[model samples]
Each structure stands twice: as C-alpha cells, then as structure tokens.
Target: MNWYVVYTKPKWEKKVAEKLSEIGIVCYCPLITQIKQWSDRKKKVEVPLFNSYVFVQLSETDRNLVFQVAGVIRYLFWLGKAAIVRNEEIITIKKCLSDKSVSDISIVSYKKGDKIKLESGIFSSQNAVIQEVTNTHYILVLESLGCILKMKYKKDV
Candidate 1:
C-alpha cells in the first residue's frame, strides 16, 4: 500500500486522523508541542505538524474509504493526480521528529548569488538569482520579470 495525503478541514487534522484510525484506516498525523498564549495565561498544546494535512497508507482502490470519515475534504492533488508520499519520506519525517539533534535537511542550500528556478506560481519555470538570505525568508531577484521576490518558509527547514 502506498501513502497518500488527505486534506482536512482547517483545525480538523487530529480529529480526522482519530476517526480514520477508529475505522481501521492507517493514518498518521504528526504533531508537535508548542506554547500557546492567551490574554490570561500561556499553556503547552499539541498541534498538528503540517496544518490541515494527514497521511494515510492504503491501496488505490481503497482510497475512497477515507471520505467515509468526517472532516476529510479530499486528497491532495499534484499535476492533476492524487499525490503519493513515498515510504522512505514518511520514515524520514518520523526519524527527524524523534531525533531533535539532527541538523536541518533543507533540500536546497541557498547562498547569495546562486541561480535557482521557481517551480510553482506565475514565476514558475523562471530562473531567479538569490539576492539575500535571512532567518525565515529569501530575497530573490527574478530578472526576467524585472521584480524581486521575497519568499517565506517554515523555520524548521
């Protein structure tokens, strides 16, 4: 069985995973602990690692079974087809979560003056030169469009 990504309603990731588990569907909802603050006090809470996403392992024919549970909107699609998550990728996510000491495994190492291609968005398939790198975002110069773009990404990566 291959792993597929399921899109859940906002803030319903954990609930959808739980319901899927109750029905014998193997689902994974990675969570992390965070300190949340309100006007009065701050408390620790477990939040879904990836917002609105849950991973499930099942056959292609059984993919429809996930829709039987509430809060499941649909499968995430890539290139007009349901996206498939590789087995090794799942294991790696679990491993990194378990081992905090592991260094950041960013797929692309961005330094100043490196030319890279924007894979998605209107700038997609266009090459951009790295202008600056910051703690949480990158400043790229897309000369073809005569505009500079700033992209923000997760701090963990």
Candidate 2:
C-alpha cells in the first residue's frame, strides 16, 4: 500500500481522517497544539498541522474508498497523477510532532555554519546549513538540493 495525500473540506481534516479510519482505511491527520486567545481568556487547542489535508494509506485500487466518507474533496494530484507521499516523509512528520525541541525553537540569535532540520513549510524535513544570518532573513544552503535559499522572516514589532 502507498501513502497518498487527500484534500479535505476546510476545517474538516480531522473529521475526514476519523471517518476514513472507521471504514478500515489507514489515515493520518497531523495536529499541532496552538494557543488561541479570546477577549475573555486564552486556550490551547489542537489544530490540523496541514489545513484541509490528510494522508491516507491504501492500494491504488482502493483509492476511491476515501470518497465513501464526507468532507473529502479528492486525492491530491501532481503532474496529472495522484500524488504519492513517501513513507519516510510520513515518519518524519510523526517524529517532529512528537519531538519537544521543535516546540522551543528560538532563532532570535543565529550562528554561522549552524545546521538545522526544518519541521514545516515548503522545506519540511529538509536539512539546511545556515550560511548567513541577518535581522530580516537567513541565507541557508540546502546541500541535499544543492542550492541556496534566501527567504524573508517576519518579526513581531
């Protein structure tokens, strides 16, 4: 069985995953704890790590099984074919979500030549070596990709 990505209705990731699981479909819906604030108080809530997305493991013949559940839009497609999620990538997500160190990441100060493993965003699960750091952004070298990435950072005022 191969893991595949599924697109879900907005705010329905968890629900879809649960429904799939109930029907004997193996699915993963990564979640993260976030602090949400209200005028009266603040609360910690678990939200889908990837909004409107869930990963399902099933045979190609059983791909349509997910449709039996509600809130599943469709299987994610890439290059005109269903997108396949590598097993290693799914393992990485599980590890990151359970790892505590990432929850305490503080990039307030940077050290040149420091290597970091990204846990989210486009570079998720990729390792990058910090080449240069500035108040606005960091220049990172992704040896695996054999390229340098320069992206902006937003800091609270």
Candidate 3:
C-alpha cells in the first residue's frame, strides 16, 4: 500500500483519523503539543501539525473507503494524480516531532518585503509581508488589511 494525503474539514484531522482507524483504515494525523497561556491559566494542548490534512496508507482498491469517512474532503492531487508520500518522509516527521529540542526549530529565511503565508496560529494561511526582522521575532505588515503583527519564526510554514 502507498501513502496518500487527505484534506479534512477545519479542526477535523484528529476526528477523521480516529474514524478511519476505527473502520480498519490505517491513518496518521501528526500532532504537536503547545502550551497556551490565558490571563489566569496555562495549559498544554495537542494540535494537528498539518492543519486539515491526514495521511492514509491504502491501495487504489481501498481508496473509496477513505472517502466514505466523514469530514474527509478529498485526496490531495499533484498533476492530476494522487500525491504519494514516501514512508521515509513520514518516519522523519514522526522522529522530528518526537524530539522536543527540534520541535521549535524554525529554519525559514525571510527578508524585507518578502511575501509569506502564516502556517500556524490564529492568523494561519493569511498572507503578509516581512517588514523587519529582529533577534527573535518577525514584524509582519499586512498591507491590504492595514494591520501589523509580530510573530516568532516557526518551521510550520
């Protein structure tokens, strides 16, 4: 069987994975733990590493089984064919996420005026421009929206 990617509804990655697994379909929905702080409390939560996406291992004969699962939008396609992910790539992601030290490593290289898409957090998938870079954060200017946001570099993008 080959691994194929499926897109899920918003916040449905975990649910879809669970449902698929219950039906005997092998599915993987990678998650990351993050500490969230509020005015009076802090808590750790697990969030999907890739928003709205899940991986499934199956053959072409079983492809319809995945589509039958609720919340699964569709399979990701490349050049009109389903995209295949190598087992090694999935293993690497699992290993990296398992290592706490490497979890927060951000390796993006951005310069002023470069356009980028936010890959995580509340403003995820929003487009912005790099206004400035400091020692620990990026100053982003959302020109069309007339807003400026400060964010730390993250590897998710």
Candidate 4:
C-alpha cells in the first residue's frame, strides 16, 4: 500500500479519513493540539496538520477502492499520475503532534468581499469586516462596535 494525498471538502479532512477507514481505506491524518482563547477561557483543540487535505494509505493500483471513499474529491497527482508523499514529511508531522507550543496563526489573504469569522481571542464570535488585506494580518473593522482589530492567521490555519 502507498500513501496518496486526497483533497477533501473544507473542514472535512478528519471526517473523510474516518469514513474512508471504516470502508477499508487506511488513512493518516496528522494532528496537533492548538490552544484557542475565546473570551474568558482557553481550551486546547486538536487540528489537522494540513487544512482541507489528508493522506490516505491505500493501494493506488486498486482504482475502484480509491474512488469509493466518501468526501474524497480527488487524489493529488503529478504530471497526470498519483504522487506519493515522502516519508520524512509524515515523520515531521508526527513529531509536531507532541509540540504544545507550536501553532498556525497566520491570516489568509482577503478580497473585496469574503466571509470570515474570528477563530480566537476577544472577538471570537464576532464576524470581521475586511478593510484591508496584508501579508501578515487582516485589518478588520467591527461595524457594530465601531472598533478595528487586526487578526493574525497562519498560512496553515
């Protein structure tokens, strides 16, 4: 069996892997614990190493089995063929699972109109207004409160 990268629905990597496993497709979804601060309390949550994607350990030769797993949009391939991930990256991700201090907090780029929700901190539940997009953070204005705050997000978050 070989590991093939699968592109799944947004926020569905973990679920997809679980479903695939139940149907006899082995998967490896590396995860790390992230501390999220929401107003009064801070809680640690497990998150995937890569968002919207995960690796499945299956036989690429078995095309029928590959296509049967639910939530699996497609396998990532190189030059029209399935591309397997190197063993080292998997090892690195496994190692990161134990690192409590490690986190992904970089903000993604924003367009003229994009929907976003605060992932953490004081404005955790408040939706942000995209005022300006920057390389490091998004300049968001809370229209109702008339306060502008910059939320930092990681590229991997």
Each model's lDDT: 0.90, 0.88, 0.88, 0.74
After TM-score superposition, the amount by which residue 103's alpha carbon in candidate 3 deviates from its true location, in angstroms, is: 3.9
Which of 1 and 4 is the better model by lDDT?
A: 1
Error of 1 at 67 (Å): 0.6
How are the candidates ranked when ordered by lDDT, highest leading?
1, 2, 3, 4
Candidate 4 lDDT over 101-135, as tens digits, reads: 76563324477457678777888887867888777
Give the Å shift of residue 117 in candidate 3.
Answer: 14
The true-versus-predicted C-alpha distance at residue 90 of model 4, in Å, is: 1.9
Question: Which one wins on lDDT?
Answer: 1
Off by over 4 Å in 1: 102-157
RMSD of each: 8.8, 10.8, 9.6, 9.0
* Ten-residue region with minimum lDDT total, candidate 4: 104-113
- For 37-141, candidate 2 gives per-residue lDDT tens digits of 999999998888887899999999999889999999988887899999999999988998899878832224557999899778899999999999897798999
Q: Give the per-residue lDDT digits (tens) of candidate 1, residues 9-117.
A: 9999999999999999999998877788999999988888888999999999999999999999999997899999999999988887778786333334689999999
Clashing pairs for model 4 are 105-153, 105-154, 106-153, 106-154, 107-153
Reference-based TM-score of each model: 0.67, 0.67, 0.67, 0.57
